[model samples]
Target: MTSAPVDQQDSLAAWLSIRTTVPWPRWSGERAAAGPPAADGVRDYFTATRGDRDPEGTARVLTALDRALADAQEGRQLNFALLTGWQRYVLHRDPVGFRTLPAFAKGGRERYGLAADTAARFEQCLSQSTQPDLPLPSRAARTYLDVLFFHPFEDGNARAAMLALAFVLACDGACLDQAHPLQVTRWADDADGAADLAVLIGILISATQRRQRHRSPA
Candidate 1:
């Protein structure tokens, strides 16, 4: 994987202040409002299914994420093992794990992630997302963007990114109503993409909070 640009890193750090005040909703209320917190909803967010081409992979991914989210809701911070398990499920055929060579995507034609030799750097990125100083939206968005830019897994990086985002939010007792928007129109090299991603997470935070408030009566 290619190294992240310094300017983009700086921009991401600066964005923590941009949406720090929006309160993260508690999972307890979400469970109450939605009738129960279900991992199936997360699968629904991606329209995940055990189709012929990748049968069982979708179910495995969903099961892994459900366990991850449940752990997060209980106040467990994300770890490499959690993410690796998710990837193993998503790319069940390749459980030996992560790309062993440089990777690239169409948007940024070259050096899209840290070179395959730098597993420690990727672990550091996941570690940083656990820092408490940043707000939920910032942490969640940064983790999502990190997964996008880091491109850690050999396949199903997008699913990993969304799961990273959801795990961060769940750690803070929040969740998004929809996550499909995160799967497209992202540019690893664009500062605006980073900023917009934070904004979108903030929007989802606010929308989810609004729904939860309605679900609870004063």
Candidate 2:
């Protein structure tokens, strides 16, 4: 007789336990230029990845990204409600809610367990996006990873993560011109990988700002 499939550890818990301990990189890079907004990496990601196969879906994601950016500009706090508003547009459905059951990803190699307070915990994490002490890149990276490991939505979590990352950066007056570099697989237990993501964001932010400076007239 074959043994039963082992229950995967809760990746969400793994993330929460180490979220604050990760050695997030410090960012001293110049902010994105105020004039002529930076190229939106989220839009590029969606268009290039899904434009051909699902044009309509791509359109929906772009719409959601615009709305999310608007909300960020208006200084709206990132929270479950804010994300759900975007998710409605993403899924083309009304009344999106947190998943009530365990969510799995990566071919079921990772599982996000749900508890009575999972939603509350997620909201607590989102609020930290505006934490005054942390650097923008660190906040952005943590928020992105939070969405990823939490697996809050039944579907479209990856889209949600990208949207959150964009919103975080936009709130801090930054945006990445290229996002393809961020498409790699992320494991919940890898603290070093999480820190590296912040470092990469800093590099991208600096590169985008540098390019903008070069293009600007003296």
**Top-TM-score structure, candidate number:** 2
Name model 1 segments beyond 4 Å from true. Answer: 1-41, 48-55, 107-110, 113-117
Candidate 1, residue 191: lDDT: 55
Quality of model 1 by C-alpha lDDT? 0.62
Give the RMSD in angstroms, all C-alphas superposed, for model 1.
Answer: 6.3
Query: What are the clashing pairs of model 2?
Result: none
TM-score of every model? 0.73, 0.95
Candidate 2 deviant stretches above 4 angstroms: 1-6
What digit string (tens of lDDT, one per residue) describes model 1 on residues 1-218?
A: 34544333322223233323333332222322333333233567655434445656767777768877877877765766778876776776545466775565553343443444456666777887876665566677778877766676776777888788878877766776666555565554455566666777777666666666666657
TM-score of 1: 0.73
How many steric clashes between backbone atoms does each model show? 5, 0
Q: Per-residue lDDT for 113 in model 1?
A: 33
